[model samples]
Target: MPTEHVLPATGPAKVRTRPVRIGVQIAPQHASYETIRETAAALEDLGVDVLFNWDHFFPLSGAPDGLHFESWTMLAALAEQTARVELGALVNCNSYRNANLQADMARTIDHISAKGGTGRFIFGTGSGWFERDYDEYGYEFGTVGSRLDALAVDMPVIEDRWTHLNPAPTRKIPVLIGGGGEKKTLRIVAQHADIWHSFSDAATLERKLGILAEHARTVGRDVAEIEVSTEIGSRSVAEVEEHHALGATLFTIGITGPDYDVSHVADWLAWRDERNAQGPLAW
Candidate 1:
């Protein structure tokens, strides 16, 4: 029987009030491995805080037959090529690999990143979605609730195995959970995630965050410790402030396709620096 790790009721830490972090998800569905490599290095040179790739077998957009690459393999390579900047999948599917294996893989990459300085590997994951990945990869595609159940079971197993591995991770691997299902998903976020990501608009994000806080209280956890993140399509400085007011300190801007134009990353980097200079806004 799997042991249930009851989360403490203290809630998340007040880290959101710290310096804001800006991240970019390098869409892997439409670029070649070489282009992806160069893009990752360039993003680091441009001073983006974090870089990410998606976990998928085929293209999520564009023509179904368009270029696509595996997530973890590319991440391992990125871990080696880049000297700075954190790296991880924007979200890896929990159902694809065994929990222990996932831990080992993450440990290996953690070592790869720790070569010069501190290791920076954020383990971003979610309950597996996209039926095509399941059918093609030979994994079971169960109901969403079932998948979440599996995630709840596997997360602790991964954490436990990390301790007993031959060489433990140099730094605590931050667990980033992505999704916005109110009941189960938010509950999981309150209980386990160090970071919670959602595709919510500012208004919706504010509303859902309130619910998440309530869930955290119910679970005897601190909501403040969990970093709240959302995707941005536009770079309106005011919109960034609006989300920051809602307690979102980490922001990810996703850029897609054949030409992974990272020109906007410079703008975001500038905005991040400006926000840092201003200090945390009073909400």
Candidate 2:
């Protein structure tokens, strides 16, 4: 593998004029598939821009052995079930499957979700982290560095497989990478991601983005081309606004379990409308 490059930071972060998009990650744990299925439909009907699920074999919270559905398989089902929302795993684990297999699965789901026009699949992926997921599923629970290294190696192969697949993915299938590792993760984001998802607050996001820009410059790409995405879990509107001011356009709220209360979703939708109504070019 080629050594990843890190260059000196230069220039202020570019201002983005993209319209704000709200996303919801319906946690698949502790809920029946029927409940999850219904929640996905409800979110789309409520006008969320994207729907996501985590890629894990078991629940990250609540009971350890709670009812949990697989990410990609449920995503394929959601592809047929929903009409408007773009959907994918919030971040699929690169260690779970072969790179080419991941590409093919994503392509099939892309086609399944297209509804005869364009697909709504966004390939959000990351290096594996959860230890139990690896142990229970018989995958190597390597160190973080090794897992990230594997991801770096797999990405080009995944992208290359897309080119050679029989019926290519619809609309080039936007790639969303989730991580904030300055040297490794951001380098992958700079090289391949159309959107970068991180869990940073405004100040950290601002600083990390400067690092991201340096990586982009090292690879001769514009950092502004990668959309900034952040989680809105329990964040107040004002807090989300802080991130928004720093050019993070895609905000996702996570709702979990049987009830899957969407009371908060309406607030986010309203925020999205308020931002977008200012016009795309509006600061």
Candidate 3:
């Protein structure tokens, strides 16, 4: 059974300009652990700000019964291997583990990276999808809304446990929420997420942001406190500007395979630098 989780509320708002962050989701469902590890190191070397893997039991693409790896174990190894670059799942399934255990695991990984610098572990989470994961793992795969309701209840407990845990995370783990359901999901993002990640083209993203802003206003929080991110399907530099115009500053491109080729990561790094050089927006 999953554990109960909660985050303590604080007063006042801190306004921050969303900075462009580029990340790569190293798809683990189809790659060997060694290949995935090397891919992670390669992505770090290529200057990607964040390195991520999806949490799953079966391959999300290609053969359904292809090579696969466990997410947190790989994350622990990644903490030990990479010298730079933040590490975490693109989003972990909230249904698989107790929230307290998740917090403790994150703390341990944070310590693994603490030798040289503050450990970087972004706690990216979402309610479970893929019925196979539930059936095979003995978890209850309820309705989507029920699962999200569970997540909304559990997030605070996870945050509270982080402080009481013996080691504690080396740094505050940025809470990233994935999904773009305007009514419930985006409202949850507005309430609990430090980062909001979704899949959408520019027009769709623009529409969602407006909905998210309404959710934020309803909750009395500034939507700017949340970093906006989306997955890139094409390598066009113009797409970056299009998403940026819609308030998306963090973009992740996903690569999957037995080979884990990430040559395009370099292009994204260059694009990020170019945008930074252009200075702050006129607004």
Candidate 4:
């Protein structure tokens, strides 16, 4: 892999833009806050394009009960600590906070990351899953369909709140909606997201992208305008290339609790640089 090329903000003149981005999801579980802060900074310095933490009250892997941290508050602090890399919860739980409050918190963090310019905060959201988070946090754990229905209702409210905020957001804060449910999740993505993220294999991604495109037509949105994102860990670089061909430019690797190791990141970073060097159409 080559070291000369870096992620371009846009493709060469006249070509449509498709920047290969790498996002690291640092799970906020089974780790000390001090350690997590240090790791966040290190990942930015190591050239990660984005930093992400899942929205959960407990560990998602390893021992069931373990050291964990809250998503939003930690994001607020991360906003101040990292200067270049974009930051956000991988997918914040929509059921945990009022839609208006969620909007306000994102705006505030967006401001925190912005040093008098467009902020680097990605407003990644989803209808809540992980029933344990809801049960323990006192939120009602509704069925997936109902949760998705609530998300559809809350999205417009969140956008409205953004408009009413005193400072507003530095930029339109790219909203990333995660999940691939055709009935509702993709529909919400069509109506609200600037980014649509999912964790699907090639065949599934192909089918879902088609469904997402149909959703876009219903909402009168052009499917191409929405950036595609997906998560990959324990997968080969060949798989990454396959997903890129399927419209996923943003690839996320999730790290679990306790040992937030990034030893595997170097190869992916090299792959990104090499692939980007071949020109935007190489993927």
Top-scoring candidate (lDDT): 2
Tell me the lDDT of candidate 4. 0.85
Kindly list the per-residue Cα lDDT of model 3 for residues 70-115, writing each as its tens digit.
Answer: 8999888998898788888988999999988888888888889776
Q: C-alpha displacement of 74 in model 4, angstroms?
A: 0.3
RMSD of 2: 4.4
lDDT for residue 164 in candidate 1, whole number 0-100: 96
How much is 255 displaced in model 4, in angstroms? 1.3
Tens-place lDDT digits, model 2, residues 226-283: 8889999878889998888777888999988967999889988998998888864322
Q: All candidates' lDDT scores?
A: 0.83, 0.88, 0.82, 0.85
Model 2 ranges off by over 4 Å? 1-15, 281-283
Which lDDT tens digits does candidate 1 get at residues 93-190? 99999999999999889889887667878899999889999998899999999999999899989999989998778888888999999998898888
Question: Superposing every Cα of model 1 onto the true structure, what RMSD results?
Answer: 5.1
Q: What is the TM-score of candidate 4?
A: 0.93
Best-to-worst TM-score order? 2, 4, 1, 3
The most accurate candidate by TM-score is: 2
Residues 43-101 of candidate 4: C-alpha lDDT, one tens digit per residue? 98889999999899988888789898999999999999989999988899999999999
lDDT of 2 at 261: 91
RMSD, every candidate, angstroms = 5.1, 4.4, 6.1, 4.8
